[model samples]
Target: MPHKRRVYFISDRTGLTVEALGSSLITQFDIVEFQRITLPFIDTVDKAREALAEVNQAHIDTGQRPLVFSSIVDDAVRAEINKANGLVLDVFERFIVPLESELGQKSLHLLGKSHSAGNVKDYNHRIEAINYTLSHDDGVTHRALDEADIILVGVSRSGKTPTCLYMAMQFGIKAANYPLIPEDLEANRIPPSLLPHKAKVWGLSITPDRLHQIRKERRPDSTYAALDNCRYEVAAAEKLMRQTGIPFLDSTTKSIEEIATHMLHEAHLVRRVY
Candidate 1:
């Protein structure tokens, strides 16, 4: 096994940009393993310095040099992090220097403004409601599967978990997922647990080749993750879904947003929020 690499992303808030950059880097290195640590909302110089020190200690303890990806907006705060002893890639420093020269104007300050005071209360209320729903989420509750807003049934790795999470998180939907195991496949049946929920049931299908690639990344040696087995399972699962009169969405090419939106619209379910 190749030695794993640790990557840290420090940001004023959310760290979304740095996360995107880290994801892009991972795609370029097929066989390397990368671990990500996000230090969000490190707005002050002291906080930024502390984060850098933590990364430095981690590198020394592990004996592996980690990469630092950062999007610190404040130059004074960024200066504190530059003292670290690893490869550091600051998004603002890297882009701002070249961009300032290109644009011929000082870059505008862009940070610390997420939501306004007038909307913050409403936003917080909605966040609270969503968190409550997720904790009390009835999606996985047994004996109540029939009441699911959307019931997803498919073979493992057919994008069931992520789809369900997206539906729940994005729309406040109570989405449930049931995996179609080998026994279910061999018997040519949807699970008895989901039979009563057939009206609300929806299938998620993936291209076998894509499924193979996803599974191989997760578990490289298993026959269950091999291409031939993936093809067999996907085909059988699709046939069973069709025979059982369950409508399905192919998830191979669509983003999670698109898939969830299609299901909501097609099923006539009203979306509570984005």
Candidate 2:
């Protein structure tokens, strides 16, 4: 059996950065199985002490010291967690000290500064992008389609909706997605409404086996979920996209984030939010 270990992401606020860092690092060691646990908002000495206890308890239970990735800003609170019976990696202590020396200045020790909510413009832009994406989903309406940074076209369950929403949420992109029904595939052409905005149009195609599996979950024992129908639809959709000069990606092996980021890069869409 692979070595089993516990990993903790400790932070002063949302713990997103800490989790991202720790998760990325642990992925390098595929031979071991890591059980991740996040303990966020550790801003006080009491909270830090509680966190330390949890880490210690994990060590006792697993007979292995947990890996702690922390970004606590409060010195007193950090001191409490420093006694954890694990390999504690301090995020701020590692980078901020070197950065301060290089710049010859003291760094801000404020809590949750990285995820500060003071940027009103960014918040507003994110909201607008989400709203726009929701309204334009599944070709609900063509209104303001010209404002979209990128548009994804694919057959049903080909992974269009989630990719568009991810782009809008993560990058503040006004993304819109449309589904290619049987009629469009039969005609062997792109949707008429999308032609006017072909410059920003992209496509997503999925493997027939994967598409069949996905559709079967949503609709069982139906033509839509049949392997033969899935194969036909995917082939026809790819053919239509190729004939219309639209670039597409095989979404079978890609995650939502990968699909969204790929579209953003290929389309050269400006990220409206940081």
Candidate topping lDDT: 2
Give TM-scores for every candidate, taking all chains together and pairing residue i with residue i: 0.54, 0.96
Give per-residue CA lDDT, model 2, range 1-274, as digits (tens): 5447999999998899899999999999998899999999999999999999999999998889999999988889989888999999989888889999999999888875553378888888888999999999999998898899889999999898999888888888998989999999999988899999999889999999999999999899999999999999999999999999999999999989788888888888776545
Q: Residue 96's C-alpha lDDT in candidate 1?
A: 88
Q: Which stretches of candidate 1 lie over 4 Å from their true place?
A: 1-141
> Candidate 2: which stretches are off by over 4 Å?
1-3, 272-274
**C-alpha lDDT values of all predictions:** 0.81, 0.91
Report how far residue 121 has shifted in candidate 2, in Å. Answer: 1.1
Q: Candidate 1 clash total?
A: 0
Give, for candidate 2, the lowest lDDT window spanning 10 residues: 110-119
lDDT of 1 by residue, 1-274 (tens): 5446788888897887788887788679888677788999989988987898898987886678888888888888888887778788898898888999999999875786543334765567456534543543323445555446878888888877777777776676777778888898999999887777789889989999999999999999899899999999999999999999989889999988789889889999977643
Query: Which pairs of residues collide in candidate 2?
Result: none
RMSD of 2: 1.6
Best by TM-score: 2
Task: Return the TM-score for candidate 1, rounded to 2 decimals.
Answer: 0.54
Candidate 2 yields a Cα-based lDDT of 0.91
